[model samples]
Target: MAGTFGNCGALSFFLTGYLQRNPNASAAEVVRYLDAKCQGQPDQSKRQHPQIRARYALNGPLRL
Candidate 1:
């Protein structure tokens, strides 16, 4: 349902996979990483960290 739709989106799927592989990273670091990968700077996408965190919390930890 709604849960599947949110997690299965391409960006979220890739982000989840990447974050899972880098569990030692702090969320700020993850935000910076994601921002860099998205062709933007960390400050430019500063808003995404909380969104990612929220999604991570809601969706559960990426398993594997």
Candidate 2:
């Protein structure tokens, strides 16, 4: 809970929620977008992934 790896569930939840709201969104947009949305919760983001960091961009550092 102090790094960007152990929060798979939260990441998936966030992405899923975002995608539900935005059906055919871009990866970069999603990631960056999510990053901004969660910026206020730095503590929860302790286990954030690279893809989450980069807004889900496959071209970015995707955890998958």
Candidate 3:
């Protein structure tokens, strides 16, 4: 997951799988989940990429 930046296909694939497992997930939850899965490891070497970021227009959780 180190070089996942700028790769839309990989991001889509990962998101699809996560959504399948958590169909009721909100937009913010999805962002956090992806960030942890891709870059939350204790080993810095495993997280070569920056943190995942997303913006949503809503005051509360945006359910997908």
Say which candidate scores most in lDDT.
2
- Between candidates 1 and 2, the one scoring higher on lDDT is 2
**Taking the tens digit of each residue's C-alpha lDDT, what string does model 3 give over 1-64?**
4224355434466788899999999999999887766554333333334343233222322222
Candidate 1 error regions (>4 Å) = 1-7, 40-64
Which candidate, 1 or 2, has the higher TM-score?
Answer: 2
> Taking the tens digit of each residue's C-alpha lDDT, what string does model 1 give over 1-64?
0123243643465578778899788888877765555553222323334555576543422222
Give all TM-scores, in the order shown.
Answer: 0.43, 0.46, 0.46
- Once fitted onto the true fold, the runs of candidate 3 whose alpha carbons sit more than 4 angstroms away are 1-8, 40-64
Query: Which lDDT tens digits does candidate 2 get at residues 1-64?
Result: 1234344555566777789999999998897977775555546435546556466432322232
TM-score of 1: 0.43
Q: Which stretches in model 2 have alpha-carbon errors above 4 Å?
A: 1-8, 43-64
Query: What lDDT does each candidate get?
Result: 0.51, 0.58, 0.55
Ten-residue segment with the worst summed lDDT in candidate 1?
Answer: 40-49
Give the C-alpha miss distance for residue 4 in model 1, angstroms.
11
Judge candidate 3 at residue 18 and give its lDDT: 92
